[model samples]
Target chain A: MAGMNMISAAQRFHAYANPARFMALSARLLMPLAALTALLTGAGLWFALAASPPDYQQGETVRIMYVHVPSAWLAMMGYGVMAVASAVALIFRHPLADVCAKSAAPIGAAFTFLALLTGSLWGAPMWGTWWEWGDARLVSMLVLFFLYLGYMALWATIEEPVRAARAAAVLALVGSINLPVIRYSVVWWNTLHQPASVFRMDGPTIAPSMLLPLGLMGAGFTLLFVTLLLVRMRAEILRRRVRNLRLAQAGGAGEV
Target chain B: MTRAFFALLARDLRLAVRLGGGGGMAVFFFLVVISLLPFGIGPDRELLAKVAPGMLWVALLLAALLTLDRLFQADYEDGSLDLLTMGLLPLELIVVAKALGHWLTTGLPLVVAAPLLGLMLNLPGEAYPPLILAMLAGTPALSFLGAIGAALTVGVRRGGLLASLLVMPFYVPVLIFGVGAADAATGGFAGEAGRQSLLLLGAVALASLVLGPLGGAAALRANLR
Candidate 1:
């Protein structure tokens, strides 16, 4: 009975792993996720742009933090998502995991790009420089951006899906180790960027006025990422089906 | 097992030496890139000396990149890589041996050539020891990390650019500490800070020595599959 129960549990876990099952689940959740993302983002931006108090030090320029900081958070968070999904794919041979990992790369890369662009915008007002190569956060974030581009490029280069996924998994796992070293090494190398303001051991130095909208924006951006990920995964699954179908019609080869 | 590993390593070393397109080519590339810099930046010795550590290091890096794809592709194309997978030698150990061979042939020669290139960049005398030492400690990490990239791209035709793209970002920490170690000495602070960066550079080398083989083996297995 215990063995039977375990077998049933495993079956149920894998039931959700089916691409059709994933598509059904994502279809149901997508509207809700997108709606919530829109609502939170709307309220958050209103507060961020209008209601939040200006930093005494930064004045109006601190407003850029609303868009910049959340995207930065989401950008790194996106890579974390990719790396975790890649790990699951590698270990369990879950088709959904590969789809999820592949989908997350472009979204993560967009967020990284946004973070860098907004960061340069913020730097211009604050540091009197459009870009600061000496800044650790900037450089590490730039590295992280390239890592995303590289991951996506690997997927594009390998014609076979399984080969691409596995090779990308290796890259992602290796990147997980390298990311921290890049972060720390840059810090030790030189640091012109400001030290950690929020998420400090001493508690966030920013006022509650800023923190609330920032939280709202962070949560909103995360949901947006999730929504986008679901959409991309759906498209990828459909694309693969079309591919398999074409191959079948031509010569009856490939896994369906 | 050790004998098998060395045999493979010896074979690669011989191929790199006999072919004359590995170490010799990299040094020549190094020389050309360094020469181009003086034209781009003008003949200002003061500026050249100021930028020498970084300039030489970057040139060495790009030169190493020029040879990265051939690290695994030759054997892969000729079916030797398939034999390697079936051999008594573990794939991870094969990876390490191959990376070691690559370092000896390509990376080490670049280290030797960097000082000569550094002279062209007007590198200060005080910076030379730390520059060489930092690179000596750092370039092995490059070869090892490059092994992972090379392995992933082994099966793809004209994968050299893709391999460099995937690999160069990981070279950041190495580049940072390497330049830091050299610059710390140039600034006359070699006692404390320079030692710290060099130590960190060595630490990166050591870490890559382990992680590279694991990653390279994983990638090679994936490509073979």
Candidate 2:
């Protein structure tokens, strides 16, 4: 049964590798995904804002973690997806992979911006400063924010689609190498900020009461990301098609 | 192959010296940036001393970036890069040669000028050697890493700013270690403490020296196509 499932999964992937099929499949999935996103996010917010207990030490301000942490999570998650998509685009030259990467940049940048803004909001009350250079995680988030901006900027600056994708892919791969360094630089330089709590080796340190809400929020954000990615990818595919059509109309110029 | 490598290196070095105020402009920009910092932040020498190491590294890094536009733009525009790409020498070697030339003309001057700027900033007497040493160890990595950004942005119009944006984040590790080494020396940590940061700085440079050329070569191939 497990082997049969794997074969079906592969077949599905192969089928959707075609753009027309992908458009149809994503269009079908979009409504269900959107419904799930709304359901999960509404529940997640209720649990986070109303049900979860305030922290013992941080009091009410700790409530900010729900919005802040999940956004940060989505920010990094979005970049990881872009990097993987870029790698696939580079190695396999898949048309969908290029669209996947290009469509993902702005979304990743938005999430990264949200993470920075929400993190600052969380920090102002908790850390007593609006910003702290001594905090490794926040500092790394800022660097990651810049990385996203550069990636998007590269895409915007290049006019040719294929050339842009290849160039942006190289930049994406190189920038990913620095992501870990940015994460660790504070430790190497001696951090004044808190160590990681949720994603630790020995399990999260937060209470179960808070953890459940955080988990729901995380799932909701991820589902929302998937919904948005499908929407954007479909739009990008259509945009490229329009460009090809226009080019063809203009004296049946060069190949698309 | 050996002779061709050195020949490329020699040719790049000659061009950097002969044209466009290459070495002098970068060092002068480094000096101006550091000098302007005192006015912007005030001339409280103690505060200046406190921030001096980091400021020096930041200035040198920017100075190196300013010179990087010339690294490939000239060769690219003159059609030599296309010839080089099609030539007997590998693209990675050419990247390495360009980075080496960039270091000699740009990185070396910053290393030499750092101590003078260090004095102007009222850096502690004990900090001078480590500041100079750290810059010496770290600036080569800037050139090498900057090469990848240069290659990636070569085909774009007015790509100098974009290249810096793409490249600046990568400089974080180098900055951290470079400043850390100087701070360790000035803070009077144990005898080996400063050495550790220096070693790490060297390690970063060595790693960049190896990986940067390959990445830059790949970017050049992609962008040139």
Candidate 3:
């Protein structure tokens, strides 16, 4: 409580603004994080495929739940991370935050696409349709996917990194507002998709036996995202260094 | 300030008109895109009429997107953008004036030409008024929103495509509501549809009016630097 009051999230954020410090911290945590990610994902897949019982209705096909749900969760989570990182880049002018936000785009896009693909595969058997436009969650997820693509495309198309970051930051912030609307559009409008069952006011509807695997899969996916994020951040740091080195060499040549 | 705004607006309009093909290209592009749709879906008049309003709206949106690059590119290249950015007026007002110019050149001409295209596509009579109304209320939002993209990609080598890519996603809501309103009208629910969609379109235009210029100004500054 004292720590929370003493140092706000913004101030705490400033502490890691320095790229060298961030790189060092990421490097230190990388090994353990990678191990945890591998271990959890391996175990989660085992439980998901072998341990969790088939749904009474969905049968074996419901196994897609483990992958689909986690990917969907991460797609939204990735956007949340992007929005915060973009805000950090804009307000605090943190260099690492820009790198964090920029590097996360393609990864988030991949997650979104995976969620859509997996959801479609699941939908084929359960809903007896490959796609349903009336499902608000599904439509919103598609929009989210496009947003991810646009964000990445904005970055790739721009020649200047700083300008790209700024433009993409504005986009990221704007797109973040849609996340909740997407989540609730189903409830607000009568859609074909079911409402929240796992994270609702009344508590989770799934039995514990099924819940265990879902929870594990969720944890595994979260760990996997963090691991991938750290790797991407490190790669960006190196790329920035290379760019700086090239600029320095050019400067030296001009001086000569 | 008002004089400067009008002067700038008039100048841009004149320049666009003088360009010979600026206004016509958007209309032509709209026609071609809509024309291609029937071939792709097969020439069933009933289907075409059913989908015509949405198709026209989508084509207009894309046409507007395709031409958005011209919103600032010519001025940026010829140093007029710099003058406008550095001039005494605030950037937001200049943006509004520029957007007005854009609407006059691209959007207004599209609206004028849409009814003709509607006839070609056999759009139902009931759909025509709402289509024009939606376009009138909505295309300004496109110009305003597209201005930000135009400003962002103003000086890029192949900015036209990039500008489209950057702006089209932002254009989605406008496309949705514009087409939705047209669909409602054609489905005999025009009176029941009220002005909610139009209001939302206006809200988008208003929001873009505020943010568009700041973005444009920032992008302009970046290009100049």
**Among all windows of ten consecutive residues in candidate 1 chain B, which has the lowest summed lDDT?**
B36-45
What is the C-alpha local distance difference test score of each model? Answer: 0.85, 0.82, 0.77
Question: Which candidate has the top score in TM-score?
Answer: 1
Candidate 2 local lDDT, A73-108, one digit each (tens): 888988898999998778666778879988887888
- lDDT (10s digit) by residue, model 2, range B109-171: 889988867866767888888888888889999999999999999978998999999999989
Candidate with better lDDT, 2 vs 3: 2
Candidate 1 per-residue lDDT over residues B103-190, each given as its tens digit: 9998999998887667546677889899999999999999999999999999897899999999999899999999999999888465
What lDDT is reached at residue B73 by model 3?
86
Better of 2 and 3 by TM-score: 3
TM-score of every model versus the real structure: 0.53, 0.52, 0.53
Decoy 1 TM-score against native? 0.53
Q: After superposition, how far is residue B79 of candidate 1 from its true place, in Å?
A: 21
Q: After superposition, how far is residue A63 of candidate 2 from its true place, in Å?
A: 1.4
Q: What range of 10 consecutive residues in model 3 chain A has the weakest lDDT sum?
A: A195-204
User: Ten-residue segment with the worst summed lDDT in candidate 3 chain B?
Assistant: B35-44
